[model samples]
Target: MSAAILFDGPKDAPFTLVLAHGAGAPMDSPFMAAVAQGLGARGRRVARFEFPYMVERRASGRKKPPDRQPVLLECWRAIVAELGGGSGLVIGGKSMGGRMASLVADECGVRGLVCLGYPFHPPGKPEKLRTAHLETLRTPALIVQGERDSFGGRADVEGYALSPAIRFTWMTDGDHGFRPRKASGLTEADNLAAAIEAVDAFLAACGG
Candidate 1:
């Protein structure tokens, strides 16, 4: 069985958003919690789960590298199955977790995808883009990214080809996790609220 942590919101809500954590944080990290709670407050049911590495960290109190691609993918699939096969569900996450979800979304046939901050490429290595799969994805997707995210900022992603099914929502002067700089006049809370609204709308459009 895959190890996971779930955050349950309104049980009778029309839809559920299954969220995963980023590369370095647990499922209940401040960012994930904020997003989950924000969505829940808007009357959307949200479920958050941790990857295996994060679960290990919780048990042993030691940091570890993320699991390999196959392991991550398998974990997502297993989680989906355990969560009742994605009916009325939108699946996604932050950064690396979001990327993994995008890869398997079509196969899982979820209602839609909502990526809080997609890692289009590795930090400082634009040549190694992780967007080939995304370019041809058929699943409906909403990618909320920081305008200045090092993984793939607005300037960087504008040149790349992405699928028509994917919609991009840029957060002003924000970084990997959508935290904006003070000079930009945008607060992290404001950006996060915008992201939650965008997600709520996207899921609504998908008939969730």
Candidate 2:
């Protein structure tokens, strides 16, 4: 797609994290920026890139739908190739980005996978699940999700037959973006920090 990658942290870091944006946000959205910068400050190299559609939107100044699934998957494969076939790399991102990463993690043979706020299913449409692949995923992965995310809340996800290799860090009263409500007495920033901490720990566990 001819998209340029934006990098963070030390150039000589042993392991690198490559992250992509969700369906609706660009790579540099506030959430993405915060996560990349947080990890970078902690001595983790992070890379961010946009999909073909997002790149088009940037050039045309118009919002567009995400590229088709095959296109997105190919883009991810290309990224992994560009980064030297994913050795010593963790691949993941916000939502769709993370989901896509999960699909390719095993194929790429990446060291680990991380999903910031996974979209378990479409909001308010629990029947339209998107987790068939997750049930048998072999790659070790971590998914940070909110307890009450409409996409896939704790009640729903706990019942799914996900792989034992997949672990979770559940946030209190979080939404799709990991933002907690006012009455919950938890700020979005709080959840974000927690997510970052969880990711750092997970990366360490993965030998990054």
Candidate 3:
């Protein structure tokens, strides 16, 4: 059986959001918990799951690198299938997890995609982008990004040829996880609240 962590909201919630953890965090990290709670409060079911490597790390108490792309994709497939095959479901997550969701979203035919912070390219390596598949994405998507994130900031992503189906919402001066610097005069809580609202709107528009 596949191993995963799930957070259930109101039993009769119309839709469920299946969220994955980022590269370095567990399924119940603060960020994941916050988003899940925010969505749940708004009357949506939310679930969180870890990739295989993270699960191993949890059991063994040793840090491990994320699984390969193929493995990650396979894990996503398994989770999606286990979660009822995408009916009334919006699938996504933080950074790396969101990127992986984008890769398989169309194939899985989910109701919608919500990427908390998309890593368009590696930090300090803008030349190495990971957006080849996004250009032709068929799934309805919402990407909430920090304006100054090292991964794919506003300035950098403006130049990428993203799919029209994907909409980007920017958090003022926030970083990869939507935490802005003090100099920006914006609090982390403010940006996170904004991101949550944007995601809610996106999901509503998509009929989720």
Ranking by lDDT: 2, 3, 1
The 10-residue segment with the lowest total lDDT in model 3: 1-10
lDDT tens digits, residues 123-169, model 2? 99999999999999988899999999988999999999999999999
lDDT of each: 0.89, 0.92, 0.90
| Model 2 vs truth, CA RMSD | 0.9
Clashes of 2: 0
Against the true structure, what is each candidate's TM-score? 0.97, 0.97, 0.97
lDDT of 2: 0.92
Tens-place lDDT digits, model 3, residues 1-208: 2685678577676777889999999988888888889878887788899999999999999999999999999998988888789766789999999999999999999999999999999999999999999999989999999999999899999999989999999999999989999998889989988988998888788785
Better by lDDT, candidate 3 or 2: 2
Instruction: List clash counts for every candidate, in order.
Output: 0, 0, 0
C-alpha RMSD of each candidate structure in angstroms: 1.1, 0.9, 1.0
lDDT measured at residue 161 in model 2 versus the true structure, 0 to 100: 92
- Candidate 1, 59-150: lDDT as tens digits: 99999999999999999999888888977678999988888999999999999998988988889999999988988999999999999999
Evaluate residue 183 in candidate 1 and report its C-alpha lDDT on the 0 to 100 scale.
89
Give the clashing pairs for model 3.
none
